[model samples]
Target: MSKFFIFLFVIFIHHLSLAQSVQLTGSVISGTEKLPSASIQLKIFGNEDLFTYGFSDEEGNYKLSCEISQSDKFLLIAAYIGYQRDTLIVSRTDLLKQAIFQHNFNLKEDKKQLDEIYIKAPNAVEVNNDTTKYNVLRFTSPEDRNLESVLKKMPGMEVNKDGTIFFKGKKISKVLLEGDDLTGEGYKAITKNLKPEFVEEVQALEHYVEDNLLKGIINSDDIVLNLKIKDKGVKKIVGSIDAGLGTNQRRMLSTNLISFINRTKAFAFANHNNLSSS
Candidate 1:
């Protein structure tokens, strides 16, 4: 009977220990103002990949649930783009309490890092009326091949496998090239072929039909992307050509030509494979 009671006590103690969990809540700020979308991460001390990540809301409020019952100490990291990262070393007492723990983080602007960036204040992301413009050169890496590759690096833009594009998790209806419908509404045509060096800035706008009768009454959530061309990138003729003959009477020929000058822009492509076109 005594052994049975001891076993029950141990089971009860195990259940009590399992019931304790930490609920972490906090706010991120920068000089009395809330910082939205700030990244929050938690990792155990002296470990490799115990990372738990979340982001602050628009009001800088954040709530994180950490499964640190096994551990009593860890590190809390908070960061945002263009800001210095901040960390907190959580002690054992904070976890033992197992209640809602409030831990705030304060971040400072990183001016030196900002200065090293390619785009400065004048060409950085800025809003004018209903349109937001961002300099493409700032977001591009040296190895980026085309506009599609650069778009994936930029914030708030995503390109899916089926050529669908999204902005801020919302679907975009149109992708235009210099205010005109080039290659129709398919995003990958221009996105894959257009050279990243040929673009200067990217403009994002909420587009709608401009009829006076349906101006504000009709609700539309259509978003469009426009690539602004640079004078030097488009003022010259550029293309590539390839022809080869292989064994078994195999022949391959492919060509691409692009020209954009003062009032004329043309693109021609031809490819010959084993498949018959006749």
Candidate 2:
């Protein structure tokens, strides 16, 4: 009878596992319109652990499957490059049978207004401190090139051999594409991976932060790099490929591709290196 008991035990465990699995489905929309290519990240509540992440399809639809216990809670964070972040809370009680939960998100635009000051333009504004702003158009020419090469030529901006960026004297910790923080080793990934052709302008904001109370609170100075992208509807493809041969029979090749269709954007990249010796 031990053999019979073992078979029943295995079936019970299988059924319990299936009961704990949950499927989440939703649609993302912006101002009554579909928001394709939206980024969806799922994480367990109060923890840094990420369960699963994926992007929205052309129809602004996304689905994620996750394993859960009786007491587990989840947080869903949705973000698009230019749109504000949207967050939702999900608990074990929300999962009932195999059902489709529809969620439509409306994103808002970031806007700013400047106050008019009664002051005339001085003949020469004293710039004792080092300050610089790089217009993306200055670096990007008709000839397509990678972001690395373009950043090297930007005024007052320096890209080191190790792929770190130095502005004035402070290192850039974050690189934003139209105001969205790239997050997690931000500048390192952006300068190394993004293409120059996609950039419309590079804005350098010194002493950056959302709250003024926190400004200068920390001793270290901060600089923010903002990359304004071209309009998606006007430009479909923006990226480039680079290959070179050097002395001692050395070879290098790299390719980056970025394409945008309406609200959906796609990015892909590849690289190869070879060396020859006698």
The candidate that achieves the highest lDDT relative to the unseen native structure? 1
* Model 2: CA > 4 A from native: 3-19, 69-71, 112-278
Minimum summed lDDT over a 10-residue window in model 1 is located at: 118-127
Model 1 clash pairs are: none
- Against the true structure, candidate 2 reaches a TM-score of 0.39
- Mind giving the per-residue lDDT tens digits that candidate 2 earns over 133-203? 45455445555445767776653456778877765435777777666664535566666777776776677
Error of 1 at 84 (Å): 4.6
Task: Show the colliding residue pairs in model 2.
Answer: none
Global lDDT of each candidate: 0.71, 0.63
- TM-scores for every predicted model: 0.53, 0.39
How accurate locally is residue 31 in candidate 1, as Cα lDDT from 0 to 100?
91
Q: Evaluated with TM-score, which candidate comes out highest?
A: 1
Q: Residue 182 error for model 2, in Å?
A: 26
